[model samples]
Target: MKKLFILFIFLLVCNLQSYSQIIFENGYFINENNQKINCLIENQDWKNNPTGFNYKLDGNQNILAADIKTIKEFGVNGQSKFVRALVKIDRSTTKIETMSREKNPEFNDEKLFLKVLIEGNATLYLYDDGNLRSFFYKNNDSEIKQLVYKMYLVGNYSIAKNNYFREQLFIDFKCETISQKEYENLAYEKKALEKFFIKYNKCNDPNFVSNETKKKKDLFNLTIRPRLNSTSFSTNNSMSDTFDIKFDSNTNVSLGVETEFIFSFNKNKWSIIVEPTYQYYKTEKTKESSVYLGGEVIGKVDYKSIELPIGLRHYFFLNDGFKIFANASFVFDFSSQSKIKFTRNDGSEANSLDIKSGTGFGIGAGCKLKDKYSLEFRYLTGRNLLSNYVTWKSSFATASLILGYSFF
Candidate 1:
């Protein structure tokens, strides 16, 4: 089992290295001199707007990195786009003012790579850095302006928000017949903003339309996993016995099928997962002794069970195609058949032991490649398997290394 686990790790490392290159796609960027340079841009599938990017001119090996200050506009085959813009951002404390002692938000103007959300009669852009989100817009290709919003302490203890974007939109696009109630009910979210812009375009020009693609949040995956399991257990048959029967740690290989339901809301950074898997475990141990007339004894245990693990997982993206994840799960194990067989030195069959079902927990960490394959190491500790023998108490634990291929 150890050798197999080591080989799995080796293969995983090799696969990671093989795909560890910047994914260059056909794209173009406008430089500081306003020259449109056709090149291949490294696509990171960024969750947040990037300050800088890598590009290869004419698809050559020579690469160059450019920042917002050096690039005016950039896009990846019209799938993703960004433009350099000077915008005002609200730097507000997430904590309450009583704890942070911050009464006013800091409004600063900075050059940023704003993601283009909609482009038509009126263009909308967004700047997101995980910590803050700000929106920008331009009318008729005019100077870009930031939609103002801030939270401030009002009176002695109350907090109030100044959502200037609502008034700005109503005044700037009054030709669309936007009502006061409509703008007031609008939420400061991506979907709401996109809807308002689409409505605005339809009001101005019936032929104007925007094509927006959203990623799916809910995912179902089926995985076939081959695992190397290290298991241990101990038992004592009699109270007056000088030596207890101990089964030292042993290794076994098992194949399991797992079904996973992933619920992601924060750009796949955090997710709720429920995975149910079926596995079989079998191992044997032999003991030699002079105290008994038989002189030698052998025990074999076999387990067929299904485990349901419900948990939460967090992912850290290494690049566009690879990520590392950690998870903690509460496992409920249901044993379909758990039996132990014993044999004496004379090759006589003894009574078989039956195990009970129980619940446990597991924690694991792993790396995933292109959302298709994953390798993980998990440790499981759980309730003991009680025996009918008067003095025998047997418990089992396992440490497993699993390799899985996901079918979405």
Candidate 2:
């Protein structure tokens, strides 16, 4: 089982490297000298605004990288646009950082690639780097400015939020018949910012039309999974006065199916999953007992079960077509038929015991290819199957390797 798991990991690494090739798309970039260069840009489909980009000239193999300071603007055709400019950034400490006796925010000027959110009379831009998020705006090609905000420690160990952005917006863009309630309800998020800018544009010109398109909706996926399973059992029977009895691990192949419902958040990186599976095990062994003088015994066990597991999974994208994921789940197992048979050396009849239902949990990690196929390895340990038997209480454990393909 360990060898198989290692092999799976090796294959996943190879797949990841193979999927990392650059994907060129129709785009253009403005160089430092304010010249628009029509070329093919390598699109990584980044979730966060990248500090640098790669481009090729005239579909050639040679690739070049450019930083924020070297590029004035860039855009993918019908996808997105970004502009590089120097803007004042808020260096305010977070709530946790404010507990260290310093409560003032530091301000500095830096150049960054801000994503163009709404591009009309009042353009709205955004800069996000996974840790800090800041919004910028410009009016009729004027200089860009960052909306001001700060967090500071207050009395009684509390924190106060200073929202200067609200005041600035109301003072700069307030027009005839625009209510104060509209400014008060403005939030510091992408949707709210976009809506406010759109309203401003429409107020200035009744014929103003938006250039933004509707985003794609959330996705639902159903998959068929087939797995290879390995199992081991251990027990000590006090009623039979026997020492530890260890059974050799057994391996089997099984088929199962699962469905995934992906949430429409954070670039579709989160999901909920449920799977139903079937398993069977059969093993037999002969043993010599030291407790019983010159005695011999024969033991056999058989198991047939159905399992249902429900869980949550999160994905980390390595590139455009490959990602790594981790998941955890709780399982309910129903043993349809289980039997344990034993025979002793005194020419005695075989005794049979029936096993009961159980529950367990599993943790696993895997890699996905193109959001359609995946390979996973997991370990499961749980409740005793022989709890109802008088002579023994046995624990069951299993490790499984699963391969899955998404149909929808």
Candidate 3:
């Protein structure tokens, strides 16, 4: 167990360092001279709009950085695209505590790299800086501009929205097939706006090309895990030393079904996991009694429980088929018909204590192959099985070697 733990720590450090390296993908950047240069650009799978990027020329080991000031445009082929545009943007605070009472938006002139969501006759763009989200648009042969939307405080407790973006869309991109009711119901969000722009563009020109990045639909997964558990248990009575006993560590097999939910952003590197497992521990020890006058006592534990571990996981992608992951979980255990029994050498029961449920924590590191097979090393902290008793105490710890197969 100690050797396996050390090996897990060594692999964890190596994988963490590997995750620190930049991931460069095939992309192109247009310079101020209107010349397009194909190169390898660092792809962070950015959740917010990036101000600058790092790139390397073909066959060059040295990397270079560029921002909106020098680069006119840049794109990771078939993944995402951005263009530098000088436009009017609203920098208003939408928080209710600090919202401006005025209904109209206060616009500021800024240069930003707008992410293209739709790219036909009528194009839609987005600028997000983690805290604020602003959308932009432009038609063929027209200057790009911000779609105005704002939130304001109404009396002391009321709030309202300035939905001027809807009116702007009605006036500029109105089509015979789109009705006024559609415009009124359209939400000021990325997916809603992107869908609306795509529909309008295709309505106007049947040959319109949709350039938006399609998000993945499979965000949840189910996995079956079978584990070999090395478990140890000990108990002591507060008033007597004869009740203290350390049972030998025992090994057992258990099964778990894991449900995982993957987040959409950050290249799908983060996830939430919930695993329900069944585990058991049984061991016996014979000790010479000090108080029983040369008589022997037999101590036995027959413990069985269902363990639920809910946790967060992070993945470091090594390639398309391999990845390493780490996770931490809080475990809640439930046991039924479980107890610790103490008996005399003559086969008469001396004492019996009912086992109670407990809570503990666990940490694990693992590697996955082809998104289907996985192996993990996990250690759970000591849990008190005598929690229901004030005078009796017990500690139970487990180390697991788990094998997983994903059905997803």
Which candidate leads in lDDT?
A: 3
Query: Ten consecutive residues with minimal summed lDDT in candidate 2?
Result: 97-106
| Model 2 stretches astray by more than 4 angstroms | 1-9, 99-106, 175-178, 206-228, 232-286, 293-408
Any idea what lDDT model 1 has? Answer: 0.73
Please provide, for model 3 over 1-408, each residue's C-alpha lDDT reduced to its tens digit, 9 standing for 90 to 100.
634664775578567756744679999999999999999998877789999999999999899999999999999988899999999888888887788998988888888999988898999999998789999999887999889899998887598999999999999998988888999999999989998998999899988879866655457889999999888788888987788888888889999999999987778888999999998788899888867644788899998999999999988888878888888899999998999999888888889989997899988888899889999888888899999999899989888999999999
Please name the candidate that would achieve the greatest TM-score relative to the true structure.
3
Model 3, runs deviating above 4 Å = 10-15, 19-21, 93-95, 214-218, 293-296, 348-350
Give the alpha carbon lDDT tens digit for every residue of 279-319 in model 1.
67677777775655678677777887877778877666667
TM-score winner between candidates 1 and 3: 3
For all predicted structures, in order, the TM-scores are: 0.70, 0.71, 0.91
Against the true structure, candidate 1 reaches a TM-score of: 0.70
Residue 318 lDDT (model 1): 69
Clashing pairs in 2: none
RMSD of each: 6.2, 5.7, 2.5
Question: Which model, 1 or 2, shows the larger lDDT?
Answer: 2
lDDT (CA) for every model shown? 0.73, 0.77, 0.88
Q: What local lDDT score does residue 42 receive in model 2, on the 0 to 100 scale?
A: 74
In each prediction, how many residue pairs overlap at the backbone (N, C-alpha, C within less than 3 A)? 0, 0, 0
